[model samples]
Target: MKKKRHLKKEAKIFLIGLGLLIFIIIVILIIPKKEKVLMPLFVGLKKEDAIEFCKLNNCKVDISYEYNIDFEKDEIIKQNKEKNSELKDNEKIEIVISKGINYQVYSDNNVNELGRIPVMMYHGIIDKKSEETSYTGGNVDKDGYQRTYEAFINDLEFYYKSGYRMIRLADYINGKIDCELGKSPIVLTFDDGLSNSIKVTGLDEKGNIIIDPHSAVGILESFKKKYPDFKVTATFFLNGGLFNQKEYNDKIIDWMIKNGYDIGNHTYSHADLTTTTEEETIKEVGRMYKLLKSKTNKFVNIVALPYGTPYKSTHANFKHVLSGTYEGESYQTDCTLRVGWESDYSPFSESFNPQFVKRIRAYDNDGNDFDITYNFKYLETRRYISDGNPNTVVVKNENVEKVTPTNLKIIGY
Candidate 1:
C-alpha cells in the first residue's frame, strides 16, 4: 500500500506540470504577433518620394529639412529610423532633407537652374537722329548701331516684368546661376565699348559720382538698385570707345572691376579671327589681355571673336590666345562667344556644349525696339524643370509634354 501511495504522488506532480505548460501556451496564443518589414533606405530620395516610400511600407513619417550645400534640395540627407525593425503598424520614421546649397544665401539674382540661359547681345544705344532713322538704320558704319535709349529702357522693364534676372558671363560658366530671382537667368552682353556704354561723368552735388542714367551701365545700375535682385552686372566685350580711351581707360577699368562687372577681349581692333593671320589674332587678343590684366590685376580669361569667326585656328598663336602664358603663369579663356541669334543651353544642363555658347540678338531682326519680347515668349513656352535631384536635369514640355516626377528612385531612373 505504501508503494501505491508513492506512485499516486508521482502522477499528481506530473499532472500539475502538464497543466502549467498548457496555461503558458494559451497566454502566448492570446498575444498578437508583431508585423515586421525591412526599412527602405531613403538617403538621396526626394521628400515627396520618401513619403510615398514610407506609405508603401505601412509606416508613418516625421520629416524636416536643413540647409546643406553638399546635398540637393528636398533630398533625404539623413534619417533617424533603424532599418528592418520588427514593429507594429504606423511606427513613426524621422527623415531629414536638405534645404539646398543656395538657401538663405543672398544674391543679386539668386536663382534656380532652369536648364537654359539666354545671353542677349546688344551693340550701341543712341538717341534717334531723325524721322528717317526709323528704328533700324541700314548704315553699319559709325553712327547707325543698336537702338534708341527709350527702346533700351522698355527692354529692361519688359525683362523685369517677364521674371528675367541678369547674371555675369563668368557666373553662368561656373554654374553660379542658383539664385531665387523668381525667374530664369538672362545675361546682357554688350559688344563694342561705346561712349554711351558706361559714360560716367563728373560727381554729383552730393558727392556721389554722376552717372548718365541712360548709359548701359547707368541704366543697369539704376534698375538693379530699384530691384536689387535684377543684378547690376554685364559682360562687355571691349575693343575701342571707352576701352581705348587712353586717358580714361585705367580709371574705367578700375571702376568696372570695383563695381562688380566683367570685361572681355573683343580683339584689339575688332579683327575677324577667321580672316586675320595667326600673328594678328595673337597680337589683337594678347594686347587686350595685357591691358586688362594690368588694370584690374586679375586674369582676363574670356574672349568674344569680333565676328564670332575662327572657332578653330590652325596656328599655335591662336592656341596661345586661348590658353597661353600670362604674367609668367598659364591662363586660358573659359569659353568664347558667337553672334548666334539664339538662346544658350544652361551650363548646368547636359545639352550645354562648352564649344558653342550662343547669344541671341537683343534687337529684333528689323532692329525694332523691344524686339526681345519674342525671345521672352520663346523661353516661356518651354523651360527647365529641376528634377529635385540636381544631378538630373529635365527640360519640361520638350520631351514629356508635362510630367512631374513621382515614385522616383534614382537607381532605376
Candidate 2:
C-alpha cells in the first residue's frame, strides 16, 4: 500500500508540469507580430525603373505625371522623401514624369533677345491730307505719311516671312513668359490714338479711300490672312483732351475699346511733363487716367509720359520705393531713372547732353522751317555756331560735303 501511494504522487506532479509547458506554448503562438517600416521613393528613377526599384522592396506606385516633372523625359524630377525615409510596408510610392523639352513659337513682327520684344511706334495714314488740324498735325510730313506706311508694311512683311507671332501688351504682361513670344515676338505700338491707326486700316488691295478704322483693320487682317499662325497686337495711346468734345473723344474711345485695342495714358493736354510744374503734371496725367478708367472701365496702368520725359541711360528713371532682395542693395538708389547714356556722351547730336537725349521734336512742315535731326546737346553748340540765330547746323561729313536741314525731326516711324 505505501509503494502504490508514492507512485500516484509522482504521476500528479508530472501532469502539473506538462500543463504549465502547454500554457507557455499557447502564449508564444497567440501573440501578434510588429509591422515593418518602408523606405522613401528613389530619386532620379524613371517610371519603369522606379517600378523595378519598388518591386525590389515590395512597394507600389501611387501616381505618375508628365507636366509635374522638372527633369528630362523618362527621368525622375522629384521624389516624396529622402531615400532613407522610413515608410510602412506596402506603402504607395508616388512619382512624377517629364515630357523633356518645350518648344513654343512666336509670330509678332518685332522680337528681341531672351523674348524681350520690340515696340514699333507709328502715326497718321490718310489718302488725302485733312483740313482738320487735330487729325492732320501739320508737323506730320506730307510724303512721310506714305513713306511711314510703306516702311511699316515692309517691316510687317519681314516679320511674317521670318515666322514671328504678335501678342498684345495686356496678354503678355499678365501671364508667364510666353515661349512663343520669346522666339519671334514683336509688338506694334502706335501712339497719339490716331483714327486711321493700324486697327482702322486693313489692307489696300482694292484701294477704295481706305477709311480710318477700316483701313488699319484691313492691314492687320491682311497680315493675319497671310500668316494664320501669326499674332498681331498694338497699343494706342490717346490724348484725353478729345474726350471733352462729345463728337470726338466719346465716339473714338468707344470704337477703340470695342475693336479690342488697348488705350494708354498720353496725358490730358499732351503737355511736356518735364517742363511742366509737378501739380500741373499730376493734373494732366490724373485727368486722362480717370477719364479712360471711367470710359472703358479699365485701370490705365501704362503711361507713356508725353515725350518719354526724364530720360536716364544707366537705369530706368522710375525706381520702386519699396525694397526687396534683388541686388541686395539700397532701395534709395536712382534705379528708377531710365537707362542713361552708355558712353557718357549724348546719343543725340553731340552738343546735347544727357538732358536733351531722346528729345525727338515734332516735324516742322511749314514753308519757313527746315527739319533736321537736332540733338538737344548739339543744339546749343549749333546755335552758338549759328550765332544764336534759328538756322540749320551745317553738318559736313567725309562722304558728303554738307547736309543741313533746319528744324528737322527725328525719323522714328
Tell me, what's the RMSD of every candidate? 11.4, 16.5
* Candidate 2 runs further than 4 Å off: 1-45, 48-50, 53-69, 76-116, 128-151, 170-176, 179-182, 198-214, 241-255, 312-413
Candidate 1 lDDT (Cα, 0 to 1): 0.66
Cα lDDT tens digits for candidate 2, 1-413: 99999999999999999999999899888887765554645556676887876777678876566632136677776677567777667778777777653321111212222112333444554433333333223323552332234334555676556444565644433322233422344445555665556333332575322334334445665676777666555666667644233444555556556655667766677766556665565566566666676677643355555556544332232222112222232221111111111111211233322222221222323322222122222232222111011111212223122222224311110
TM-score against native, each model: 0.63, 0.47
Per-residue alpha-carbon lDDT of model 1 for 158-205, expressed as tens digits?
A: 877777767778877766554443466678888888867877676567
Error of 2 at 59 (Å): 13
For model 2, state the Cα shift of residue 161 in Å.
Answer: 1.7
Instruction: Give, for candidate 1, the lowest lDDT window spanning 10 residues.
Output: 404-413
